[model samples]
Structures are given as C-alpha cells and as structure tokens.
Target: MRITVLVTAKRNPDLDGAACAIAYAELLREEGYDAAPLVDGNPDAEARFALDETGWARPAVSMSASEIVLVDASDVVGLPDAVSAERVVEVIDHRQHHDAERLFPRARIQIEAVGAAATLVAERWRAAARRPRGSTALLLQAAIQSNTQRLRGSVTTPRDLDAAAWLAGIAELPDGFVEGQFAARAAEIVADVDAALSRESKRFDHPEGSYVVAQLELPGAVGLVDAVAAADLARTERVMVNLVDVDSARSLLLIWDSAFRRWVAARLGVTFTGAGAECSPAVLRKQIVARLRGDAS
Candidate 1:
C-alpha cells in the first residue's frame, strides 16, 4: 500500500505552527496527494482558541508516513526522534536556522523570515491562484494576526501584513475579529488561570540554564495569580510568566530566578523594582526564547 503524506509542526506548536501544518496539508491534498496534518504535541491555549473559533478538530498525535513535510520549524533538535532529517522530504518555515541546509540538503526548503509560517503558506496558495475556505481561512488569518501581534509586533514584516490582508479578505470574520479573539482568550484565563498558564508554558535550554517561559492574554490589567499558583506552573529551575494585556500591548513579566531576573533587567535596560516588571513594549514568549538561545555563548 502507498503511504500517506504527513505534514506537521514542531512539538507543542503555537498558533502559527498549528495553523501552518493544517493549511499546508490541505494545500497538498488539493493537488491530489494523500496528505494529512498531524500535531507533534498538544496545541497551546491561544492555539486552542483559534481551533475552537474555526470549529477545527485537534490534530492527530502521530503520523505513520515514512516521508514527512515539516512546517514552522527547521531545526532537527525541535523535531521528534522518529522524524529524522532523512525522512523530511520538504520544509516550510518562517524562522531561519543555520543548520537547515546541512540537515535537509535534498529537501525543498523554504525558510523566510516572516512573522508567521502561515504567511508563507498563504503566499504559496496565492501564487497558485487558490483561496482557502471556511475554517482553514479563519485559522490561518487568526494565526497571522496572533503571531504578528495584530501587526504591531517588531517581528512582523511587509509580507506578513500582505498575507493577513489577503486572508482577511477571504475569511468570514466577525466584526472586530482580532479584538474579539484576544478578548475570548483573556476571558478563558480569568475563568481558570492555572489551566491557562499550564497550557501556555514552554521550556527552552540555554547555555546559562534551562528555563520555562509562559504567557497569557488578559482583557485588561486585572489578571493576577498568587505566587503558589505561579510556582506550581513552572517545571524548571527558572521561570518567567508574562501576563500580556493585548489591548494595550503591554505585559507584566514575573521572574523567579534571581540570576535570570538580573539578566533580563540588564538585557531590557530596566530596573527590577517590584514583584514583576512591566514591559511597555510587549514581548512574546517566542521572542524571549529566541533572545535566550541567541545570547547563549
């Protein structure tokens, strides 16, 4: 029997990663390939909101295909052990990695520096004169907007904005869609802060040490959790929880490790005056992880 084609993102995929995997697989299937999108791990809270908003099902946990297409991430370290570089037949990503060419030399690789991988997938669809419909369009649009922080994040590029504009044109979004989505996520956090934090938390290994970084959306500046709950959410030696007020584009950063606290204060050119530091220019958890890994010696 012929094996099916599996398209998936890295483990613990966020909005862009999950959306890209599903969208790209649909694109391939339209071209007559037996393709399916699977999630390497469970989606995060914000990603779940997008899934629920579009009525899309959560991705299957595993793929039995021998050959696979990777989306949103290029580094082999981020992939599962069963998916080796040799099995990667193609790569689609917005984040650039130095080892992509070396790892998947024979695969058709696209590593653009856009804010979201969904932008790249949309560009491909537009090039083929194909428009995503219904849930796919909605999820992809939300992924673009969320990753770009409603087009206000520093990581956003012109291509990302263009893709978002195209997606918005096709998607049957509600009035004030972006704002409504953020508000929904904030409400979920308020309903259960512990569940929200646990779903959003991700860990990274740095030269200094391994640490957990988590984030949550808040309707306003009123979302607060006790230290015990915060500590319970962390599974690493150091942890940083960022409570982001999406409407205002600001974040309250709570740090646990003293060394990391000092490092972050120095890096951001700020002084730690209280329990947590308020970042005027809101920072995403992905940006924090990038900064942490990039600064490692």
Candidate 2:
C-alpha cells in the first residue's frame, strides 16, 4: 500500500530534525493515517547516538508516497530527491531564514523561531491528549535538550520549555543523559573536526548574499577555532565557519572571504583579530541569516 505520509527531515538530519520526523509520523499514525518516517541520508553522529540510546529504529516506508511532511526542514535545497516540492503537503520548521511557502506552494507551512521543531510536534501530542510511547517522548526530549543546549540557547522559547517539561514527565530521562550525549558528540567532533564540520554544513541563498555556513557544536568548541582551519572552507564560493560552544554558550565565526568578512563585521559589530571573532551567548546560523535579511526585530 502506498504511504499516506512520508515524514522526513533534511538530507542528513540532526536530532532535532530526525526526532520530529519520527515523532510526528507516530502522531500521524495514531490519528489513523498511514504514515512512516524515512530519512534520505544518514543522520548525524548525535542523532545516531540518540536513536541507539532509545532503541528507536526506522520501520519500512514506501518510496512512492501519496504525500510528504517535512519536519525541521524548510528549503528546497534540503528536500530529498524522492520528495518533489509538489508532493510536500506539510512543512513544520523552526527557522527564521526559511523558504517554505515560496518553495512548497501547496504545502501547509508552520515556520516559527522556536528552539527545536520537536517542540511543535510534542505540543501536537499534548493537543490531541494522547501520550507518546516512552521512547518517542525520550527522542523529543533529547532533541529539545540538544537544540536549546538544555534550555540555555538564545533561541529557546516558552513553548520549547513547556513541551520539554511535559515530555520530561513521560520520558523520565536518566540523570546525566544530556551530558553523555554532549560528550559523545564532542568525542566525535574532536576526533575528526574536519569531518564534523562537513557533516553539519548548510548552504543558504538570502537576499543579502548567497553563501555556505559550516558549523561545529560541542561544549567547548570555542577553543578549537585556530585548529579548525576555517580559512580554507571557501573553494570558489563564499563560506563561513561557526564554531559554537553549546555548553558555555559562545560562538566563534571564521571568515574566509575578506569582503564578506567586512560585511559581517559591519553588521554584527565585531572586529576580527585575525580570521576569527568570538560572539558570546552564541548566535545560531538562522539568527545571523535573520539579522541580514531584516527578519530580526
């Protein structure tokens, strides 16, 4: 039978995107719809760790689907080849620099600036008055913790906090679970920073400029700025590297393009001592994009 809803995230989703896909698909199935979660590419190290910890495996999903629901993904570029823009019936994302409505014209869109898209999916479970299974709740809870840095990130919202709290009651996550997740991710990054950088990179085309932003997130990535060699990120196109310390809540932006560096310096009020500049209380990539596109208030 054809799948009614094929829920997915970006090409290689992190925990936030992967959790939303699986959890929202569960919600759809509970509502009596034929739905399943499918990721086009492999999830990142952090997501892999969570899936293993929760023992939440991906079930079979039909490649040909009647409709698609994109969670934590908004742009056409991130859409998998199997999911044509016309097939996307719904888009639920939490980013400011989004092209959801414009790209997926027929899709019902919800693009808020919340910390994690999983927060919205958790709210749906609460709205329906249906409790998710323990593993599902755990996944959503982990995603919120990762995205919001345990409710310390600047993008965190009250909705994120409430959803996390509700899920906490259901999940009963173990003590030091967040710490373990962070340590696992840090080991993966510190082992091979270049690969970590490549794994988490994303490209954007805003009205201000078209460029790519590569990110590395861990507890103390701020110290790894000089070792990152972010100056070589730009092969032909403009590229910027953001090394974010999620624990301490700091960001170090590495600029390879001098002209673009000047632009960012002017916009963000930062002076580059060398090729990198640090911003405390860390700013997310979406926030930078929002500021440049005038989406920030």
Candidate 3:
C-alpha cells in the first residue's frame, strides 16, 4: 500500500526530526511498502528534506491520495480539516498530554515520554526483526543517543537503553562522540546574558485553566545551562521556564515569581525549583486573553 509519513519537529536544528523520518522511510521501503517522508508544514515541495536550513518543496498531492498516513506525533498540534484520509497512524512522541480522542479519533495513538520518536521507531523495527543496514541504522543510533543525552537524562528508560545498545551493536557508534558533541555545544555561550536568555522563550495559554510551557533550541555554539540561568535572572513577572533539550531528553523548569514558582514546584515535582521575577510567554498570552475577555482571575 502507498503510505505517506508525516514527520515534524520544533523548528530547531538539533531535534533532527527530518533525519529520523528519512531513515524510517528507507526501512519501510526495504520492507516493500511504498513510503515517502513528508515534512508536516513545509512550504516548498521540490527540494529534499533536510535540517532547518534546508529548503523543501510542499507536496502537491492531497492526503487522500495515500492509502495510509503515519504521523510523527511529537509536533502535530492540530490537523487540517481538509484532510479526509481514512486511516492515520501515530508514531512516538513526548509532548504534553492532549485530548487525543477528540483530535484524531482514527489515529493509532502511541505516546511515550521518551527522548525521541526515533527511539520508538527503532524498537518497532527490532521487534519486527528488521535489520536496517548502513546509514539507516547509523542515523537511528545517532537519533537515540542525541535524544537521550548520551544516556544521562531522567527520561532515559530501560527500554531506551536496550534500543540504544542494540542499534549501537549494529551501527558501531564511536565511544564518547555524543558526549563530546554536547560539550562542544555547551561551550558556545558567551557573556551576553540577555542574548543568551533570548535563545529560549516560553509561552503559557489559559484556555480554561492556566498551562505554561517553554521551548528553546541552542545550536552547537550555545550553552543551555547558561542560557537557562540568564532566563531565570531576566524574569520580571510570574512565569516558569521549561527548558527542553531537544537533543538530550533532559529538561529544566525554572520558576520565577514566588507564588507561581512555589505552586509549580509543589505540583509538578520539578527537579530544580527556585525564585525569580520572569514571566513566560504562556503567562503573558493568558493575561492578554483574560484582559480582552474582561475576566480577572
């Protein structure tokens, strides 16, 4: 059957969603499935998919043309109403929980709080006795290692470790390469505190209840810890910074403003809790919406 794989990632170079999609598509093709990887919201439709910097052409065909669609659930916030596909499948993801039944009722939901969706795909490949060769296996191995922080993050479960071990055996990844990449990336943060803080920004939304979230992607030349510290220092209002390491599944929640900070610390079980005076983008958006609605909460 003809299948179209929808892959997505936060607009960050480090996340490597396109690479994972390419690898998975190759494996699927080897299995005799006509599979092609499509970037979820790509504006271009001709150029082959690449990292954030690469240009891609938007596919001209409709989603209904495919017999089946596999979506990278990590970055699929909402689906277009124009999509009339009969069958849609979801792959691995670790985004915040949402109303899946209401959103995509026909989808095969598989949400695991793992580091990367590629890890989940790799497990599926192994279970099916699919031995991806050459570059496919190597890319999968890199995706897992980068997502798991070289196996240092708390989200690195036993299953993830197992998948990494198996893929590494076949791919033969160099020792300490992942760790070295992280270190090299961390050394790029300079003394410009404000610019560094701006590297990561957060937003909060209050649909009915207040929910806060942050997103950031530091390049190979930026230090995440320093950026987070700068974010904490720059807080002037009520907000929480959930700094997600797109490469490493590690995340740090920086709570500024005393009241909200304490509430999040107690409720969310944050690993690092402290006080500051910053406001997240989510909080700001909520406040604006509240003001516009003439409802003070």
Candidate 4:
C-alpha cells in the first residue's frame, strides 16, 4: 500500500527538475525500488515543451509514498505543502543554500555545484551501469542543455558535459528538438511577461538588501526587459530580472534601485546603463544570492 520512493523537485519546476524527477525515478525502479516521479505542480515553459514533444505527461500525483527523494529541490520552501519534509530520505541538488540538513536531518544529502541537477542524476544511472529509456535520455540531455544555457552557463562543469554527451548517444532525438525546446520557453516569456515573471521568480537575500530575482533565457532579451518594466503591476517587493541571452552567453540585470544597482555592479563587476546592465553569465540569480551566503559567486 506504500510507494517506496517519490522523487520530486520544486513546485512549478523547470526542465532540469522535471527531467531529473522522471529519469532518477526510472533509475530507482531499475534497482528494484517501488518508485514514482511526482511533479507536484505545473512544469515551466521549457519543461512543458520537452514533455509534450517527447509525448510524456507529468504524473497525476497521489502523495502516497513512504519516502521522498528531492531531485532538484533542497529546501522546504521549494517543496509542496502536502510533502512531509521529515519523510525525505535523500536529496540530490545543485544549489548551495538549502534547508536539507536542517529539515531532513535523517536524509542523505548530495549537493553539487554543477549547472544542472540532471547532471548528477545522469551520473547515478551510469554508476549503476544502467541505461535509461531513449525518451528519458533525451529529456535528461535536454535538461542539461536548458539549465546550462546550451552548456555555456556559469555553473557548467566537465561532468555536465560528460552527462550530456553520454545521454546524447542514447537520446536519438529529432534534429531540432533541443533548439525548439529552448525557443519555446523564450517565446512564452515574450508573450506573457507578467505570467513568466510571477512563475519564474524566486526571492533572495543579498548583502545589500533583499530582492526577488526572476530569470528568463532568450536570444534577444532587451525588448522583453522593456515589456516587464512597462507592466506597471503593483510590485511590492524589490525585484530584479536576470535575462540571459543564451546565444551570446551573457546576462542582462534589470533593476530600478540605483544604490542597489551600484552595489550589484561593484560586487559583480558589471556596468549599468539606464535600467539594465550587460554582464557575463556569472551573474546568475542564484549564484548572486549565494554570494551573500559566502560563496565566491
């Protein structure tokens, strides 16, 4: 009557989280565990595009598992309210700041600094000398690309490259699937700036102050930046949108706080002009927040 392991990620997860859930769950099942991947909320744009293209649908979760394994998520804040933190038995994440040790004191924790958590999951499959299904491999490969900005992101590692290369051989994907997946998410952000911002935004603690960082990866993100700025919504929190141009391997930080902008510039060595500043991919939102946590971000 109990599902042995329910692997999951943050609510409304991106491609990296969703793919890690499915592929990692497959690895668990292969090892004779009664496992299932639970996507507690809707998948983000890139994730939805990947699943739909691959003809895979996220499971309708029941939350009846005996144990929980967080794939891309590590903090209690990112998980669903229905999920019991105490039941978490394992965590595989790529972020530095987490409640993993405190909330899941009894759980096994594996946190790395790789670009994608999917990189870690792919390593797990390899360690067991197993091969995921073609679809799973494709999804994992796509997740690596998405999280790594086509493998050009700041957190990208040799292991990320190794995982993607290994999965590519097994993926057998269509010629344009990866590019299409990336384009779909960027187009969605251009279409609905408000929705995208609300969905993709995450709060952060900065040494200068507290701010929310919303991220989007688009080829030419200046127009999208203008659109988000013009929305005129009642934004109560200090928010900065870090728009990454994957094509250029650069980031544009959009903010209105002049003093805080100077602080960001000094901390990150980026110059500002008007409402936005063009910087390297090292200006990733989470990476910036980790700076406050004493990481050399």
Error of 3 at 182 (Å): 3.0
Model 2 per-residue lDDT tens digits across residues 57-152: 678778788899999988877667779999999999988776677899999998887999999999989999999999999999999999887788
Residue pairs with colliding backbones in model 4 are: none
Q: TM-scores for all candidates?
A: 0.78, 0.92, 0.64, 0.92
Model 2 TM-score on a 0 to 1 scale: 0.92
Off-target runs (Cα >4 Å) in candidate 2 are 1-3, 206-209, 234-237
**Considering every candidate listed, which one attains the maximal lDDT?**
2
Which candidate achieves the best TM-score against the true structure?
4
| Lowest-sum lDDT 10-residue window in model 3 | 43-52
| lDDT (Cα, tens digit) per residue for candidate 3, span 1-297 | 555544333333343354455556656776777665554553111012122122233334344434334333433343333333344554445434444445556666676656566777777788778877645565566666655555655445687788778887777755654554443444433344344344444444554446444443223221344555555444655555444453534344556567766655554433342442222211222222334234533
Per-residue lDDT of 152 in model 4: 83
lDDT of 1 by residue, 69-132 (tens): 8898888866755577888889998764346888887678898778889999999889988887
What TM-score does candidate 4 reach?
A: 0.92
Residue 111 CA displacement from its true place in model 2, Å: 0.8
- Residue 275 lDDT, candidate 4, scale 0-100: 68
Scored by lDDT, model 1 comes in at: 0.75
Clash pairs, model 2 backbone: none
Local distance difference test scores for all models: 0.75, 0.84, 0.49, 0.82
lDDT of prediction 4: 0.82
Model 1 clashing residue pairs (backbone): none
